[model samples]
Structure formats: C-alpha cells, structure tokens
Target: MTDATHRRPSRLPTRLLGACLALALLLAHQPARADDALMAGVHAFLYEQAQAHGEDVVIEVRPPSARLPACEAPQPFLTHASQPVLGRVSVGVRCGAEGRQVRYLQAEVGVIGDYPVAAREIAPGTAITADLLETRRGDLSRLPRQAVLDEAEVLGQVARRPLAAGSPLQAHQVQARALVERGQKVTVEAQGPSFRVTREGEALEPGGEGERVRVRFTNRELVTATVIGDARLAVDL
Candidate 1:
C-alpha cells in the first residue's frame, strides 16, 4: 500500500486569507486601544490630500508680534493616534471647519496640511507665519490672533475720551506710571536766607514735579507739599 495519504483542504480561501492579512496589518498600524473617555481636548489633524485641484491653499499664521494664546480643541473627544498633543489643552478660540474662510479657530497643539500647512501651536513666544490668503474674505483667521486678556486687563481703565478713527496713540495716555511713596528722602537746595528746607521729612522716590507729596514732620504730623524744580520742594499750606 502507498504511504502517501489524501491532502486535507485549506481552512481559508485564497482571497479570504489575503483579506485577513490586510486587516491584521491595518489593526497593527492603529493604536493598541482607542480612548473611550470624551474629555474636552483639541484635535488638529491635516488632511491627507488637498481637495481642490489647482487651487491655492494658503495658511495664515499670526506672528509673535501679536502674541496670541494657545489654540483650543473644538470638541470634547479622546486622543487620536496620529494627532500631536502638547498636553492638557483647554478652551481656546474656536476654529472653523472645512471652509474657504474661517474665523476664530480655537488654538490647538498644531495642525498639518494637505495644502502646504503653516499652522503651529500658538504660545507666548511662538512666531506667526505671515501668509495672507486672498479669499472672498480677509486673511484666514487662525484659532488665536491676539493674546488672552486677563481679568485685570479686561477691567482695566479705558480711554476716557473718544478716540477718532486712525488717531495715533500716546504711550502715557494708554498706560499709567507707578506713583511715588511716602518717607522717601528727596534732595532740596538752600536758596537765599531761607534754607529752603523742603518743609518735611522724606520725599517719595521718583517724586513727580507739580505732584502732591506727603511730608512727615518730627512730630509725626503729615503735611502735603508740592514738588517744584528738580529736587526742589514747596510746602502746601
């Protein structure tokens, strides 16, 4: 009798085997596990390819001159395997999705591009790329264009007078300087018979001219005086 026995049929078909192999490869390429928790986070991903053919895809980035805040994620979602994360993102400016012109895009970690992306994660010192896009609207607005206005700044003093359009602003009017303190030793000069002893104890540091200054006497009494010429002082009765 012949030793060779009849061969058993293969469990999987040729096409089925090939499909199984392809599926396995795809699974391997993806993350080991998908995050199910939906926490508020940013999602900045570049399209694999550009959509419109022969169309200019321009990306406008805000330069460091303005110093904008971080780009935020649009929705609450889990992290994707391919997405770049800068860790613990928060609610930033909201960005537009799939539009020729987008306004107020929330800042994100960073964005890639199918159409030559120049997008990046916005931060304190991030340099913005000046790429103006000529669309129906103005320049493409990114997630963050300007810095975050803190509570102090938001409620800070505004221009008391109405500013006309295209008016040049002076630095002093916009910002207030530090005021002088009490008991600061100021230099006074002796002129004529009256040894112009600046009727007081000490003067405030950086004492302002024509500004009120508090003078403490040896008796611990407070007397207000006026700052006159350079280092000169006059007691205000």
Candidate 2:
C-alpha cells in the first residue's frame, strides 16, 4: 500500500474574499460619508465667494437629510445669482464631469464686514459727506436687505429719508445726487479694449451718478448710457 499525503487547499483566498464582501456591505450603509465630502466642498466654494466681497465668512452648511447616490467632484453655485449671499440661502450643486447629479443645499452664511452708517442724525435731502458717514462692523447677514456696505456708495449722495444716528443705511435710504440734467450736453464716452471714442450727446432725461440715462447724438442716434460722473456717460463697446 502506497502512503499518499493529501494537502488541504489554502483558505487564505476565502478569507480575503470574505473581507472584501464585508467592506462592501459596510460602505453600502454609510453612503453619507460621501455627502460629508460633498458638503465640505460646498462650504469651501461659498467661503471663497464671500471672501471676495471683503467679508470674514462663517459658513454653516447643512447636508441633505436624504441619502444620495455616491458623488464625486462636487461643484457648488448660487441658485439665485441675483440674491445676496448672506443669511439663509439655497445653493445648487453639480456632481461629476457630466453633472448628472444636481442637488440643492440650504446654508446660513454669516458675513462680518463694515457697513456704512449715519454718523449723526441725517435729515432728508441732506447731501451725505464723509464726515456724516461712519463705518460700523457687524454681521452683514443680519442687516436689512440691500443695506449699503461701501462708503463710496453713500458719499455725496442725498438722503431719501431721515436716518437715526449710528443706524445702518439701506438702498432705499439714499439717492445718487443728480449730476446730469435733461437736455444737457453730455460727453458720451464709448470705450473698448483698444480705444475710446467720445461724442457730445444731448441727455433725454436727468440721471444721477451710476444711473442710466438716454442720450441723443448729433446724428439723431438715440442710445442709453450709464452716468459715470457729472455730465459724463459711458458705453462699453
């Protein structure tokens, strides 16, 4: 009788397979881990945008409660581009190169920055001087909508209504001082990348700085231009 020794097949491969299966199961239940990265990406984007406006931003990002498909390469943008980034906002996010997954996120952005306030009691129709305006630091997110943030925006402008001392000014509280009058000869500057052309045009309507006014050129060409300064208008070509 010949003695034959049988060798047992290795169980190492079976153990490795079992580990992989366990990992897959664990990952399936923890889909929100990817969402954590997604929200982080969203926060970074919002923080950068807010920083561009010269504000110290504190962003509170809220993740979606529902489980979402595993996402990679997340991109975030303002859902309403015209709306201010402060306070509670809705952000739209796109995932992957194809952007096949689109999701909306809610967030609260605290913007700490300087805003213009009345240095003293301002009466209506009073021309705002630098002495009359003071800078106040606070969370701009809590300010009234359209609150003035830049001192340049109010300097030389006229108050539309009475403002209390040390109170933040809003867009409705002031008006740009009228600089161009109707039928006045205004210099219409058409500027381009390479050159600038200026022509004299009669203003069809009165406009203040940063306001749009209609101008009629000598050739009877009517165009709308922005008032840049006193009797000055510009058109970008």
**Clashing pairs counted in every model:** 15, 0
User: Which residue pairs of candidate 2 clash?
Assistant: none
lDDT of 2: 0.88
Q: Write the per-residue lDDT of candidate 2 for residues 42-61, one digit (tens) a residue.
A: 89888887875556889999
* Every candidate's CA RMSD: 18.1, 9.0
Candidate 1 C-alpha lDDT tens digits along 189-214: 33556454444366545445567666
TM-score of each: 0.22, 0.71
lDDT winner: 2
